[model samples]
Target: GAGVSQSPSNKVTEKGKDVELRCDPISGHTALYWYRQRLGQGLEFLIYFQGNSAPDKSGLPSDRFSAERTGESVSTLTIQRTQQEDSAVYLCASSEWTGRNQPQHFGDGTRLSIL
Candidate 1:
């Protein structure tokens, strides 16, 4: 893909249901990130994956939220036992990551609605 692509632009589910959001980043991009945006707030960092070493998940809200990346291509964000408070737009971004100020490409985001 030429840019980051996210699937299921809108997701609606019961409060306790689980949801899986997917992100396919631009080819060759080594850094991928996930963030959450509530009704009217800034993007909240969730997790970051850089290459094969390990993932930085310090920003994740709770144990119910998790993310994973496959090499440098695709990433998946999973929310377990979703709560009403989890309703928000989940954003995904990718950067080439050669160090020195690289602009990240963003996906439209998945709008999750926990009813």
Candidate 2:
């Protein structure tokens, strides 16, 4: 795809289950980011990967959430022991660079529901 692509657009899982969300960034884009949006809420930054630099995971809400990007290609966001509060749309975005002024293009997002 020419833009960021995320799989499993909708997921339903029980509380305490673990889920893995995938994101494939646009080719040649050097910066990738993960964000989550709860119902009626704004997007929340989750993690970021830029080239070979160490990923900035400061946005992750807790240790149960983590993400990794191999080079500037695919990235995955894993959430362990899912809770009802974890239900949201997980969005992926990529940009040509990580500079403050760089614009990012976003994916449709994966909607996760915890039963």
Candidate 3:
């Protein structure tokens, strides 16, 4: 793949509805990350996945948010009982490795709106 690819470029849902966002990482990349960006705030790291290692879920704001990745391929982020505050652009990124300085490629993101 050329880069990280996120599906459903945009989404709109009711406050209590649930939504799922998908991401496809570049082939061979071993590190994947999920982030959320509010209207005027900086990107907030949501979770991270590294090859065969335990995923990092500390960044998830609440129990309603979760993510899963199989191997080094696709990832899905699920949000339950969505809230207005959860509305934002969900960005997915992938890197060749999981290092502090490794360069990561990002997808265009899924713009989520909660009504």
Candidate 4:
């Protein structure tokens, strides 16, 4: 892909349903990240993947949230038993990390609505 791409853009779901959001990162990028933003809240880091090292999934809110990355390619975030509090923008970003500081290029995001 040319840039980070997120799917659906808008999702409306009843409470307790499951949703899967997808992300396609920029080609050749080695790092991928997922973030969640609620209304008026800052970006909440959900997970990060770099190369073959361990994925950082520490920020996931609960057992209902999980994600996976295939090498340095596509990634998917799944939220099961969604609740009203789950309504937010799910953003994905990719960066080519060299040493320490590499700015991530972000996707617009999947707007999940759990009513």
Which portions of model 3 show Cα errors greater than 4 Å? Answer: none
For residues 5-27, what per-residue lDDT tens digits would candidate 1 score against the true structure? 99989999999999999999989
- Model 1 compared with the native: what TM-score? 0.96
**What TM-score do all the candidates reach, one by one?**
0.96, 0.97, 0.98, 0.95
Clashing pairs in 3: none
lDDT of model 3 at residue 32?
97
Tens-place lDDT digits, model 2, residues 63-92: 999998888899999999999999999999
Candidate 2's error at 52, in angstroms?
Answer: 0.9
Alpha-carbon runs more than 4 Å astray in model 1: 98-100
Q: Would you list the C-alpha lDDT of every candidate in the order shown? A: 0.93, 0.95, 0.96, 0.92
**Candidate 4 lDDT by residue in tens digits, 1-115:** 5789999899999999999999999998899999999999999999999988898989999999999999989999999999999999999999997346788999999999999
Which residue ranges in model 2 land beyond 4 Å of their true spot? none
Better candidate by TM-score, 1 or 2: 2
Which candidate do you rate higher for lDDT, 2 or 3? Answer: 3
| Model 3 lDDT tens row, 1-115 | 6878999999999999999999999999999999999999999999999998999999999999999998889999999999999999999999999898999899999999999
Cα-lDDT of candidate 1: 0.93
lDDT score for residue 33 of model 3: 97
Worst 10 residues of 3 by lDDT: 1-10
Candidate 2 has its poorest 10 consecutive residues by lDDT at 1-10
